[model samples]
Target: MTTPYPRVELGDLPEIDVFSEEFRAAPWEVTSRIHSPNGLARSSRGIEGLTYQSAHTVLGDRRPRIGFDEMYQATGFDESSPVYQAAVTSINNLEGDVHKVLRETLGRYFTRDFVQTLRPVVRSIAEEILDGFVPGEPVDIATRLVGKIPSRLFASLVGAPLGDAEFLEKTSDALLTVFYMDNANHEVVEKAYAGLAAYVEDLIRVRQSSPGDDVVSYLLDVERSGRITRHDVIVNVTALLRASTDTTAGQMGLVIAELAERPDVWERCHSEPGIIPAAVMEAVRWRTGAWSILRVVREDMNILGTPVPAGTDFFGLAVAAHRDPEAYPDPHTFRLDRRRPKPTLNWGMGVHYCLGKPIAQVEMEEVVRLLTERWTGVHLAKPLVTDGEPVNSRPLTALIGHTPR
Candidate 1:
């Protein structure tokens, strides 16, 4: 198979590197230029990679697997290490019946109705955190408000002790660095993963001895059936914890910041809570936390006429796909009225779509709803800035000043 567009060589396009400072500084600009003639391009980078920018072609294609074990082995981690075990065995890495079983088992807690049961838990946490912020004062909402909600909520969901949320959040950050940072220290990441494993093990032991209506107890029940082991419980719990923490926090930062900048948007959401859900979807489409999904090709195939070799790593760039004009009219502008003809790839596509999406949407809507209800207006003290390496792009720091309505 051959692409209708000419195959562009990586040597001819050096600026497309995701890790490059130039690209990170202006990713949308670079992605836009590279995708002018085609939706897919083969990277000259030695990793045997493909870069995809179009949502029209990339989503719902299952040939490209996350290849968690492949990446773990490629990175030279010891197979027996807790970090390696967690990385390679987590449900995020599993495929076929294994993935299906684990996902179905966990689905009991992550469903829309189940997540709604936690609304009181989420509102309580939001109220406590907001109570600490004085009206008309500048605070780094990025760190103080947006960051804490998800961490605390995840802690509550898994039945971790009340005071353990902050510690777990920090550990999750460190663990994420191992995957997101190009030059992250292996020893440091391993230590963080080890710490998380020990904590999860303790939590599991508590659940086993004294069951509760929480995720750990549910996993323990599954384990009792001999379908899964204690180790599986630890890994699955850690996966939920990690996915729920920083990624959600980052997306919250973007949503809140945007609302602050656009009073029309804020007032609309404030006056009509029903519209907050659509606003959250727009926020995700506009400023995605998951910039890309890493996958490895299982067999030789063609992507929009471009020949792809087996065992090649592919980067399905959600950042670029969300900005594709073909999928979104006036793609850069955030609009609640926008009807997505094709589903947004922010939460992912196909079987690997994010299971935490339901809870995440509820959390985002609540934060926006509660913040608007409490504050007349939320404005940035300084322009919200996004700066980071390719592996961990996020808002830097901005003090959000607010006034009582």
Candidate 2:
């Protein structure tokens, strides 16, 4: 069942470590070094869809059964690994009817209506965090502002006390390393998976007795109806906690950090609140913390004329793809109001498209709105520092000051 197309092993393509410092700092430059006419990247991690079309295809293609479980295993994670064991049955790893069932079951809670209901909540949280900052004073915006909102929001959404935000933030980063194969084996990852699981179990128990209009309470109701298992409620809720925290935190932090560096953009976004939604899109495309979407195929498949053997890790490298000149003009410059053929790939695409996207979007949009309201402009107090990995590009430090309103 194979042709003679010389199965292109991405590892052999020379000088591209999609997870390396170079790739982190300059994904487009690193990807461009691999001159594959077929649009395949040489990154050892796997085949990359560096262009917008190929990235969309690689991420959105369901014919060959694209999934993360296979890719995680390809990275050598087995049942022996705690994180693997916990997530293997979660919706992130499920596919077909099983995936559809769980996805649809969870989808009810994330409806546009539900997300809008949370906006006032998002605004309330944002304002409280902003209130802590003194005028004309530099603050650790990364930790105090950008990092606080989403994790706090996760707690509120699940009906967990706001005090748990600290735990969620800690484990959320440890849990986030799952996306990066190099960082997945860190000692904290196992503890994160285990700890979050325990915390969620307690959360489910509380919601069982005091059910309310929250995600956990809703899942508990579904559990009683025999639509989903208790374990499903526990694992997926933990998964949602893991899902909602760090990525949104990272993106928010990046936007703040990047905007600090670009006062022109900041000034405009501040002056015209209506442009924040577009600014969010432009900023996400500019330096998305979400670098790639990890996917694997069960059978050998051809991607953009590049032959990929069965069970190989196929990455839709959003870090590079979003910057593809063909996809967006002047791709490097962070300008809003630019029209594009497709929506941003940062949230991913197709059936496995992020279930929490609406929540994340509302959180991010509301954040930009909040910041613009409080400050006429923002400028960095210090240089931004990050892990620099294409996936989960976390800002380690982002000190900044907001101009008085």
Per-prediction TM-score, please? 0.90, 0.91
Please write out the lDDT profile of model 1 over residues 1-405, one tens digit for every residue: 334656654334233567767766655667777633455554533221223334334445776777776655555576886678888788887888888888888886677789898777888899899999877899998888888888899888888876998898788777676554333457667777788888888888888789998899988988999988888898999888777888888878887887888888888888998899888788777776677666777787765545567877666677767777767778778778886445666666777788988888888888999988988888899988865645445676768989988
> CA lDDT of each candidate?
0.74, 0.77
- In candidate 2, what are the lDDT values of residues 137-213, reduced to their tens digit? 88888888778888899999899899999889888877766566554455667777789888888888788788998
TM-score for model 2? 0.91
Residue ranges of candidate 1 with Cα displaced over 4 Å: 1-15, 20-22, 35-37, 44-56, 70-76, 181-183
Q: List the residue pairs that clash in candidate 2.
A: none
